[model samples]
Target: MYTIFHAVFGYFFMLLAVRVLVRRPGGQLTPFEFVIIFLIGGIAILSTIGHDPSVTNCTCAVIAVGMVHRFVAMARTRWRRLGRWMDGLPLVLLRDGQWQLDAMEGMRIEPDDVMAAAREQGLTSFSDVKYAVVERTGSISIIKR
Candidate 1:
């Protein structure tokens, strides 16, 4: 029915919006980012259900959305390019103690962020780090020298 169509559309729309809006992974989301996500999800749910308050309509919408999500996940797995497009490749923030300024800027990362990650890995000095990468999952990885 219309609910199913709305659910599929809303799912894709939200998927695209979240991919564009959220650069960091779920664990690293800021409070403001979390608020944004919640608000967006609420809006998507409202729009998808439209004026339907019936349990059947709600159940159907949920199932449609879940099936669409599962299909996309499977498609991404089968198609490497789709997976790469959905989840970007890892970025090198630092290599051999040298900062990749352009990559850092593009990713909105800073030396302090890299240093914080290094600190978490028990690296006190920049010289003690050999590589720093912004993983596709939006986690900063530090490699010791």
Candidate 2:
């Protein structure tokens, strides 16, 4: 029963970390967002199935980060400028049917990634994507030209 208790709590709370902390924040990914996921995964594993680090320790850390995430989300929404700092606004990968190779390189996304996204949308040529945005959530958002 005790084992089940820890496992359930950690599992559900991890969902909160993903939902409220990550998606609800901005539906986008920034470097900070990546870090939060990496840390949460490490803590979740140790707490869910390991004993060296107690479940309470993991829960506490998760709660703390969750609170901060929520605060940032609220702040970003309330203040437009702050939100931009906390959550990166979308970047244009293509404009007027032209690829922005420099932006793609800076964002560390290869051309193939864009092509794959395009193919998913039935776009066989570059001109089909009017604007491709690499969202703050580290996901790609494509708008067909």
Candidate 3:
């Protein structure tokens, strides 16, 4: 009986909890977006495994983290200061139609990786790459110079 009760409440509240907490409410998630996802997963596990100490405790923790995440996300969008910290600064991978060999070595990314991303955008030759950048999203974007 207790197990069933917790299951129903857990499922229901988690649904309502996520709905009320996230921004862009019902939308897709990106790779970096998975960080918050894992965070909520931990909260869910805590709320369900030992719901005895009160599900309220886990619920409150989830609400608090969600609020903080929402607040940070909003501030990041409004202010460059916050955005840069969370998303990281962009890096240049190519310059003047040439690969920045030193930069690539430093970042530990290889030529093949750059070529792969470039190929996805119709670039088959190195000379065609005007600028290749590792954007804050962890994706490489290339410009044909």
Q: Each candidate: what lDDT?
A: 0.88, 0.69, 0.66
lDDT (10s digit) by residue, model 2, range 29-140: 5687778888987887666556645666666555655665677678778999976654556777777767788877677677787787789899897778888887876577
Question: Which 10 consecutive positions of candidate 2 have the poorest summed lDDT?
Answer: 20-29
lDDT string for model 1 (11-35, tens) is 8888789877766847478797889
TM-score of 2: 0.57
Clashing residue pairs for model 2: 28-136, 28-137, 29-136, 29-137, 130-145
Q: What lDDT would candidate 3 get against the real structure?
A: 0.66
Each candidate structure's TM-score, on Cα atoms with residue i matched to residue i, is 0.92, 0.57, 0.58
lDDT of 1 at 69: 92
Candidate 1 lDDT? 0.88
- Largest lDDT belongs to which candidate? 1
Model 1 scores worst on lDDT over the 10 consecutive residues at: 19-28
